[model samples]
Target: MVSMSKDTPRLDPAAIVTSAMRIADAEGLTAITIRRLAQEHGVTPMALYRHFRDKDDLLDALAARLLADIRLPAPTTAPWDEQIRAVLAACLAVLRPHPAVAGLVPARILLSEPGLTLVERTLALLDEAGFAPDQATEIGSQALCSLVTLVATEPGAATENTDPDTRDDVIRAKRAALRALAPQRYPHILAAADALTLCADRDNYYDLGIEFAVAGIRGIRPATRTSG
Candidate 1:
């Protein structure tokens, strides 16, 4: 650990957030305490408290930072469904790398500028799709929730940071366990053991989710109304 000195640079809000994210990424969100962050940054806990009133305040800032990292999809002339998919895909790209934040974001009401910006852009896309204000709001809420669910429940989701060898061992164990089931009693599990253990590749997994969401949204439109 680097020792603090008289010449040590003063800690700033951005630096605090950055260090917090690093710790969360490496050791999960629960490990990100003010003391831990201060220790990592070679500062005292009081230094972090200067910027954030408490752990919740620090977490709120961390959530904002995660949202800020997401690059919003560029405006395109594509159909609204395509635009929605693009927006969600961008969100997934940002959240997947920081899976810990994926778990944290949904629990908090995001009042930060970056979080509000994402919500604004999403609502705008829904508006462009011709939904009424209330419908757009509901759809936007559902879409965001779906994005969180996808990251939270997807297989191997929680093991992203685990050692490759350990992950492989877990997968192998699951596959073997499924294969060991009685054929007559658990025929489906035994038959598809390989598929049960392996997860879809990232693109396929995300694309399927986007397609499902878009299809559901499309289904809600009046049958006589044609999509552009």
Candidate 2:
């Protein structure tokens, strides 16, 4: 005869990832060793193996876990600009909370259910805004990539000490140097340099880009209408 008790407690894979994320958020990815996780949880390393195949598998789980927290507003229900804003805001929020995991996000293969869910929502938003199938796919890919880079690079690309004015000046100087390149050598780039330098507000720029994309898709709404 066997006795079943609710007091025994359960070891969830999700809980393991949450713990790993805590360690990562504090000391980075290197801190997330199987042994360390086991020690924190008062279990053996082999116990974690039961949940994750190895470290990479654990990382995949961590990425999935981090992604799962972000929720995109329903595109069908919300205004197009609002929906896009909501998604980007959510993406930034998620990454901001887990600084250690931000860099790893773009590299890891995000095939997990949560990852797929995020992609599906993004595609649905594009489709709702009237992007053609191919266009939606391409835009979603590009938008996601751009968002990741923007979050990683903007605000603080490097940890050097400088006032905001000095930092802006440094950025401006860099752009000026790029602009100053011989026009004959890179005609189109030089032509666009002034326009690029005018883009100062990172957040505002992102909003504008997303708005333009949404508007572009809306313009094409008359051409092709597809339901997702």
Candidate number achieving the greatest TM-score relative to the actual structure: 1
Q: After superposition, how far is residue 66 of candidate 1 from its true place, in Å?
A: 1.6
Off by over 4 Å in 1: 1-5, 107-110, 221-228
C-alpha RMSD by candidate, in order: 4.1, 7.9
lDDT of 1 by residue, 1-228 (tens): 445679989878998888888888878889989888888788888777889999989888877877888888788899888988888888888877777777666555357777777788777877777776678778877877787787666776566677999988888888888888889999988877876666658778877887888888877762233445
Best by lDDT: 1
TM-scores for every predicted model: 0.86, 0.61
lDDT of 2 by residue, 1-228 (tens): 222245635567888998989887667789889888876766667777899999999998887776777775655576655676678677766775566677666555256677777777777777676676788777766666666665555444432235678867876786788788998899888876655554446567566655665565455543355567
RMSD of 1: 4.1
